[model samples]
Target: MHGLAKNHLKKILSTCSANRDCEYYPCHYNNQSCLWCYCPFYPCEDEVLGEFVKRKDGTLIWSCMKCNWIHKPDIAAEILREITELTLDKTTECSIDYLENRELLMQIKNKIEKKLGKSNAI
Candidate 1:
């Protein structure tokens, strides 16, 4: 493939679709793909997408397996772009700070939207 085509292919490979034939697949409603099997912005405090559950052992678990926000194509692509900008390639740790401080997240979103020349539609 040409260099430009190869570049586009690389972008797609950044978060490809999950296997549809696998059992226990389509874990979320609407059959959203699990491209983000492990969310980078995990431990988030998005009450709409996740919640905290206390186990019998008195340990709190952040149950987010059912959240399909990251599985959406646009969201996944935007997240990958933000990660690239943040230079988080070699980072293994993520913070819940963005949850508490939404400014950071909003700044990134605004920048991305401006770059794409898109309005922040609801």
Candidate 2:
């Protein structure tokens, strides 16, 4: 895996050590965890998982504060596995633009679905 990807995977695998410090520590949801404090695949084209929010400065941001799909250990692990196989040579940006990488996103989604044994993306 590339250095950036590998580092991301490591962070996902590590459970949140500061969960207790957060006001909303444990969300009442199955498999929910704080592993994905910052989603690598932020602004993913999963409308069901997130929506665009306009901040006071008029900057559009993908808000997924209520989404916990990536927090599941199994899902995170599966995503990391797929990420390890990617040849991300075109970009070095921390956040991936869904429209710009539809093919890669589809592949990762397929792998994730297969890993979870379900077609539901999430």
Backbone collisions counted per model: 0, 0
TM per candidate comes to 0.55, 0.53
lDDT of candidate 1 over 1-122, digit per residue (tens)? 99999998766554366546547566664445456667655666556667999999999989876566667667656766775666554444444433335666656645654655342121
Can you write out model 2's per-residue Cα lDDT over 17-97, one digit (the tens) per residue? 325545666652543556666766666756666688899999988887656677666776677666655635435453344
Report the lDDT of model 2 for residue 16: 41
Q: Which candidate's lDDT is highest?
A: 2
- Under the 3 Å rule for N, CA and C atoms, how many clashes does model 2 have? 0
Each prediction's whole-model lDDT (CA) = 0.60, 0.62
- Identify the leading candidate in terms of TM-score: 1
Kindly provide the TM-score of model 1 when superposed on the true structure, using C-alpha atoms. 0.55
